[model samples]
Target chain A: MNNNETTAASKASKPTHEHTHDHEHSHLDETELRVRALKSLLSEKGYLDPEALNVLIDTYQHQVGPQNGARVVARAWTDSTFKQWLLEDASAAIASLGFTGRQGEHMVVVENTSDVHNMVVCTLCSCYPWPVLGLPPSWYKSAPYRARAVSDPVGVLAEFGITLPTGKSISVWDSTAEVRYLVLPEQPANTEHLSEQQLGELVTRNSMIGTGLPDPASAVSQ
Target chain B: MTNNSAKSNLTATADVLRELPDIPRRDNEPVFDEPWQAEVFALSLSLHEQGVFTWTEWAHTLSSTIKEAQRDGDPDLGNTYYLHWLSALEQLIIDKNLGDAAQLNKLHKAWDTAARNTAHGLPITLP
Candidate 1:
């Protein structure tokens, strides 16, 4: 077709798509209004309070997250008996460390083996092992992580810069009723001669969650 | 002298109030007054809002659960209370309608916003 003819044809098609797009925009606005109304109803029945809500939000941000997980990882590295106990019964074992029974009650610990590795996701929601590990990271609670982690764990982990060896199948545990999991990462190599405190330094929060293993070099540098 | 120290003292008092703990009440007596309790309370309330359980049920469950924990020799009040609170929240979230797959999508988005940039706290953007 000639250039003008082609241009005329494209112009005719553009309006249809634009009309659909505008329709979708308004549809989304209406949906948002419904959701807001529902949420407001939930809030009004004494179900939600702004002050309490702020406190919950603040606790997750300031008190939980990497810092809390680090404590669990450090303890696991320094104490062999505790590591065994943690793998066996995470809740009771964590209680032994004076960090028991919080947001993640139905606690289970997954041990990383040479042939198989494990990661956790709460596909239904952001169910986490909060007592031992503290609040989950934003990514952990994300749908992309929750949905993809089960079906394509290696792929998801790779996005987090974690690459598993060939022939190693990744087992993704879905946190549901009566069972929540924490990952017991493999201890770092060449740290046999290090003191317990030094070993503890090698353990990072990511290691405990099985996303990434600890780097001895960074630990020593810090 | 010239009222500067007085002003400094007032500022210090405000700081103290900000740092004040939310204690668990026993016959209106403050028992587990600690910063952590506030965290537990907030989590519990969030779960309740999500409809995990009614407040009455939560109160009953928590009281019994705490007693059991104490019996088991885990007497750390703040931690134990939080443990119960967490359980209640989890159950509540699980129990809610959660409605369709679209609702799940909305929750995922909400969680992402809440969890990220969380250096501050839970965002006001939660639906």
Candidate 2:
């Protein structure tokens, strides 16, 4: 082989760490190591299709996520009729808005009023509203969150740096496989003029999960 | 504006996500913290398609694994979420008689060798 072809051929044949330490060795976490191992095993066994894996990852990583839910929250906040419909029959209202699928088939949008605050958790497992909220965060799926959200909603909120009113009664919704819950955080005081899209900018992932409030419209408006 | 924003979320989502200092995000989107998390997640779904285990079976295994970890004094901090997921997958593989413990271990070792010998950012390939 000529000089260029020989170089290219060797590089192609020996694409390994032993080639040269041109860059720092990247460390893979323990779970990551195991996952890679398992993935390879499955692929070798003809069970894991790389194309199918990419499709699933792309769906959650890009196409579906909390952004879908945020838009729903913003619309509910701005449109009174939509809000009413959402409260009355959330699944239909949300699906009407085009955010409907697995883990969101039976949605329950709980309102957070001055006298009451709502928090959601899955005491049994991470049964979150995936269509709107996407996958549950690590914190949402944790044992502490699942265990304490029901018994002490306020305390759980405090841990998240959210302190509700001492007099306000907190309601902890334990989401199930049959139904999912989303928190419609009270529209902040000075957000009447914001457009639905602008208001949706205020809605955050945690707000829909009841662990946080929407970003104040004033912040975005300013 | 509503129609436009719904169709395009990266910009607006990024703005608000920046304000929440405590939450982990990439490109202003809430996503798996590591590649492994995503792989394991999709692995479960892919395996289901392979009929390795039903969704109900997978969920039950995962839930029970979490419960067992909790009973064993696992703090269940954010980190362990996917570890339980991996455990569930392993359990299902063995339970379904797809592979025994020894075979799985051998596969794991092969990957480890490939990983050790592979260059950073290069695909891990087994001979």
**Highest DockQ scorer:** 2
Q: DockQ, per-model, please?
A: 0.03, 0.19
> Which parts of model 2 have CA positions greater than 4 angstroms off?
A1-33, A103-105, A217-222, B1-30, B49-54, B113-123
Each prediction's interface RMSD? 23.0, 10.9
Model 1 Cα interface RMS deviation (Å):
23.0
- What is the per-residue lDDT of model 1 for residues B46-68, given as tens digits with 9 covering 90 to 100? 76556566655554555455455
The TM-scores of all predictions, comma-separated, are 0.51, 0.75
lDDT tens readout by residue for model 1, A1-222? 356544654666465545433322112232333334334444544565667667666755456555455566667777888888878877888677676554334567777888767777666545567665665554554445555565555555665678877676667676653466788777777676676666666666666666777777865565
Error of 2 at A135 (Å): 2.6
Clashing pairs in 2: none
- In candidate 2, what are the lDDT values of residues A1-222, reduced to their tens digit? 246544654676567754445332334556666776777667667787888889989998888888899999888888899999999999999999887764223788889899878888778778788889888877787666776666555555766778776677777787765668889999987888888888888888888888888888444555
* Candidate 1 docking class: incorrect
lDDT of 2 at A114: 93
The TM-scores of chain A alone, one per candidate, are: 0.69, 0.78
Scanning candidate 1 chain A in windows of ten residues, the lowest lDDT window is A22-31
Listed for each candidate, the true contacts retained, as a fraction, are 0.03, 0.30
